[model samples]
Target: MKMLEGKVALVTGGGQGVGQGIALALAAEGAHVAVAGRTLATLEQTCGQITQRGGRALAVTCDVMDAGDIERCVSEVVDTLGGLNILVNNAQIVPLGRILDVTDEEFGKGLDSGPVATLRLMRACYPHLKGDGAVINLASSAAVRWDASGYGHYAATKEAIRALSRGAACEWGPDGIRVNVIAPHALSPGLRGWMEACPEEAAAFVRSIPLGRVGDCEDDIGRTVAFLVSDHARYLTGATIPLDGGQAYWG
Candidate 1:
């Protein structure tokens, strides 16, 4: 039997990148997935891919910054898939700017999009999550160490997510719910943009990693997420698993 057979998974930011990868991976494991994102077209694309592969999935339009959107998304997941057993908070926005260049508005946007949205989604899914349910928060290697100059805001938000995941695990473990964070260093489509935006710095950043190769989206980070939400990680909780291919270790 598949690892997540008959389970229902709700993944935010499932329209693309790591979120899309995670949604597809979960569906491959026999779980019904709700692909939630602000873009209906992108969400539909992800949903279509799942269904075409003989998996069940639904596209849900959600803006993580909005509480109502999150609540509605969770409700739809339960209503459509029967129950919620896995919740992956993967939606985030990265605004590149130096610390002095970052405005209060931009800082607020980053915070709201990252850790704040993660906390809101967790709270929305808490009541529907059954015993043994899993919550996986998508974090980043930026939280583990400082690399670039303009990513302090982004790193701070991810760090908050890591701490939040640990706190939630400790509080919710008694209820048989596992909460964990995955700090990925994968080559998603966004990687090109990030690299191109700062080529010299990006190259320098890659040189710091021992693996010498950036990770692939689905095979690297997605697999880690899949495993964390499966029975294979039943004994794991409150842990931050680094999928950076030794980047964090070398740093």
Candidate 2:
């Protein structure tokens, strides 16, 4: 039997990058997927790819900054896709600035897009997310390793998400709802753009990693997420899985 044969999933920021990868991975495993993001065009693009591969998909326009939009998108997914079994909170604002330079608004942007949006979606999906329900919150290696600078706000927000995921995992375990976080170091579109702009710096960064290579967005990060939501990981909860090729280790 397929891992996600009768499952439905909503992936935030599913328009591009890691979110698109996770959405596609879930769909390929037989889950009906809803691609949600601020841009309708990109969301449709992701959904198009899924449907083209004979998977069920829906494109939902959702701005994580807006709680109303997040709630509506969750409802839309449940209504349109039958019911939502998995939720991937993969949307975040990456603010590149020093702690001293980042303004209150800059920090707020990360919080609004990360933990706040994730909390809203979790609540919105709670009623319908029963029986093998799972949530995958995206964190970052920057936050885990704590060796990077110029992204203090972004790192803080990601850490906050980890805390939220832990709390949710503890509280919702009784309801059979599993919540976990993923810290991925993948070759996403945004990362590729950064690499192009600072080739030397990017190369140096990659060299610092023990694996000496970044992960593929779909094949690496997305597949890990797929396993987390599958019955294979039914016993897992409140875990922070680093998908960074052994770059960021908690222990």
Candidate 3:
């Protein structure tokens, strides 16, 4: 049988990039997925792809910064998909700049899009999540490795998510709800833009990895998320799994 057969999943930022990949992956695993994001077009595209592949999916318009949107999103997913079995918190506004160059507004933007939204989503989904339900929060290698050039705010929020996931794991484990973080080095739209602007640096970064390659959004990161939400990972919780192709390690 398919690993996630009969499961219902919700993926934030599911309009594009890693979130889109994850939504499609979950659907491929026999789960009906709700692709939530602010953009209706992109969400529809993701859902369309899933439906074309004979998987069930729904496009939910949601702005993570809005509390009402978050609440409504969880409700819509449950209403449309029957029940919420998995939640993937994969949306974030990535701010790139040296620490000294970042302003309060810029830092706040990162927090609002990342940890704050993650926390709100978790709380919104808490009551709906039954025993064996799973949550996969996205983290980053920047947080684990601390590059120190750019990604200061991004790293901070990601680490915050890791901490929050650990807390949730402890608090919700007995209830059969598993919470974990995935630090991915997948090729995202932001990463693609960076590579185009600084091809040499991007190449060097790839070379530095022991695996000699970065990760693919759908194939690498998405599959890891699928595993995490499956019964195969039933014993796992509060762990940070690095999906960076040997670029970084986390204990």
Candidate 4:
């Protein structure tokens, strides 16, 4: 049997990159996935791919910054998918800049898009996730790196997500809900853009990895998430997993 057969999964920012890959992976494992994003066209594209793979999926338009949008998203997932079994919060506005250069507005965008949105979604899904639910929140290697540099704001938000996930894991574990964070090193859109902008730095970064290669969104990060949310990972919770191919340590 498929690992996630009959499960209903929701993936925020499911329209592109890692989010799209995750939605596809979940659907492949027999989940009824709802792909949520601000862009209907992109969300629909993800759903179409799922359909082509003989999987069930739906597209939901949502703006994570808006409380109303967040509430409506959860409701739609529940009403349309039958029930919510897994949640992967992969949406966030990544604010990049040196610590001294960041503005209040820029920092606030990171806050609202990352931890704040994550918390809101968790709260919205809490009631439905009372028994045997899994939540996978995205973090970043920037959160733990020694030289965060231009990643200060991004790291802060990601670290906040890690803390929130840990707390939620402790509070919700008794209720059969597992909460975890993943600091992925997939070749996502953002990463690709960075690589194009700074080829030398990107090449150096790739060589620094023991694996000698960047991760694939679906095959690497997405599959891990599939396993993490399955019964196989029921014993795991409150953990911040580094999916960066043996590059960084979470200390």
| TM-score for each of the candidates | 0.93, 0.96, 0.96, 0.98
Candidate 1 lDDT over 118-161, as tens digits, reads: 99999989987758799999777765465567778888888899
Q: What is the per-residue lDDT of model 2 for residues 1-251, given as tens digits with 9 covering 90 to 100?
A: 77899999999999998999999999989999999898999999998999999999999998999988888888888788899899999988877688799888888898898888889899899988876799999887776556667867888888889999999999999998999999888888988999999999999989878888988878888888999999999999999998887877677
Which regions in candidate 2 have their CA more than 4 angstroms from the true location?
none
How close to the true structure is residue 26 of candidate 2, measured as C-alpha lDDT? 93
Q: By the lDDT metric, which is better: model 1 or model 3?
A: 3
Against the true structure, candidate 2 has what lDDT?
0.89
Clash pairs detected, candidate 1: none
Candidate 3 wrongly placed segments (more than 4 Å): none
Clashing pairs in 4: none
Q: Using TM-score as the measure, which candidate wins?
A: 4
Off by over 4 Å in 1: 146-148, 194-205
TM-score head-to-head 1 vs 2, winner: 2
Quote model 3's TM-score.
0.96
lDDT of each: 0.87, 0.89, 0.89, 0.93
